[model samples]
Target: MQRDYNLIDSNRQQQQSKRGEFLASAAAAIAAAAVAAAATAAVAAAAVAAAAAVAVAQQQQQQQQQQQQHQQQQHQQQQQQQHQQQQHQQQQQQQQQQQQQQQQQQQHQQQQQQHQQQQHQQQQQQQHQQQQQAAAAAATAATAAATPATAAAAAAATAAATAAAAAAAAPVNKASI
Candidate 1:
């Protein structure tokens, strides 16, 4: 009877010990589940924050792009204006050069006309001198003819002097031309 009583007490203690271990395991499982739930909540909050930051950054980048585009357009407009001004200046310079060339041409033509007039005057003077020389020679021949003794000699001398004058005048006219 004593041994049966001891066995019964031992079995009761073993059952109590198993029940304590199971309760401890159940508490640990509950604690683990709570921690997992908190972790999942924190992860979701962080994801939301990151998404907000990305959206703000994208909006700022778009605004910067717009500003840059506006500035580029203004710069291009300025460049176009400068190009037009340069072209206008170039055109004006070309016009000035053309005017200078025309003036030079006109001056050259006037100089040529003046030179021609001077040449004509020279030719007229040379012709007048030749006519005077011829008239003087004729007068000398007439005087010699009245003397009768040297008439032939005077005529020959007058003819030689006239021929010499014509030859000299021919060379002078050719050199002028």
Candidate 2:
């Protein structure tokens, strides 16, 4: 009975040691699970920060693009205004050229009218002088024709009167004989 009691006491001591080892293993597993949960939360926070950075960068790029578009629109409007001003200047030059041409035409017409009037006056003076010369020549020809006929008739009448006077003087001299 003493040997049997010694064997039972040894077995009981061995079982108590196994139970203490199992309790220590359970505690270690819970500690490892808590550490893993903390590491996962840290990784999720890092991912959220990266997404916010990307969104900010995209918004800045959009703002820059809008500013560039507005500047281009202003440049196009200035170019259009310059083109319109150039067209207006060209139209004004064309109008000035047309006015100059009209003035030249009017001057040429006035010169032509003045030349025609001068020629008409010269022709009138020439016709009046010719008429005066023709009248003077006609009067000179009539005077020359009348003078020669009157001188010849007066010579014939004087010769017949002298012949009658000679015949009467010869009869009166017969009484003296």
Candidate 3:
């Protein structure tokens, strides 16, 4: 009976040791699983952060591109406005030049008219002087004819009449008369 009791106790101890080993292994497995879960969560969080960073970078790039496009559009608009202003200034300059040319032409025409009027007045004055000279010559010829009875006087009268007839037949140039 003592030997059977001792064997029974020894078997109980062995069984208890196996149970303890199994519990220890189970706790180790649970700890390993917990560690794996934590690692997986960390990896997931890192991925989320990286994805957020990439999205932010892409948004920033898009905004920068939009701003650059806006700046380019503004530059193009300013260039067009400058070109239009240059064209307007050129047109104004052309108009002023044309007006100046027209004014010069009008002044030249007025000067020509003044010169022609001066020439006409000179011609009229010459014609009046020629008529007075012709009348004086006619009066002198009449007075000599009334007292002329001698042959020499008669010949002088004939020559005077011939000269007067020749003068009437000649074309009068008022400027040279």
The numbered model that scores best in TM-score is 3
In terms of lDDT, the best-performing candidate is 1
The residue-by-residue lDDT of candidate 1 on 80-174, one tens digit each, is 99999999999999999999999999999999999998988788677858775776767575766656787777777677667777776766667
Q: How much does each candidate deviate from the true structure in C-alpha RMSD?
A: 8.1, 22.6, 5.3
lDDT of 2 by residue, 55-147 (tens): 999999999999999999999999999999999999999999999999999999999988886776566555544544444444344444546
Per residue, candidate 3 scores C-alpha lDDT tens digits across 1-177 of: 999999999999999999999999999999999999999999999999999999999999999999999999999999999999999999999999999999999999999999998888788667756765775676566656665456576556666765765575355544435
> Model 3: runs farther than 4 Å from truth?
148-177
Worst 10-residue lDDT window for candidate 2 reads 168-177
- Residue 110, model 1: lDDT of 100
TM-score of 3: 0.77
Q: Which is the winner by TM-score between candidate 1 and candidate 2?
A: 2
True-vs-predicted CA distance for residue 122, candidate 2, Å:
3.1
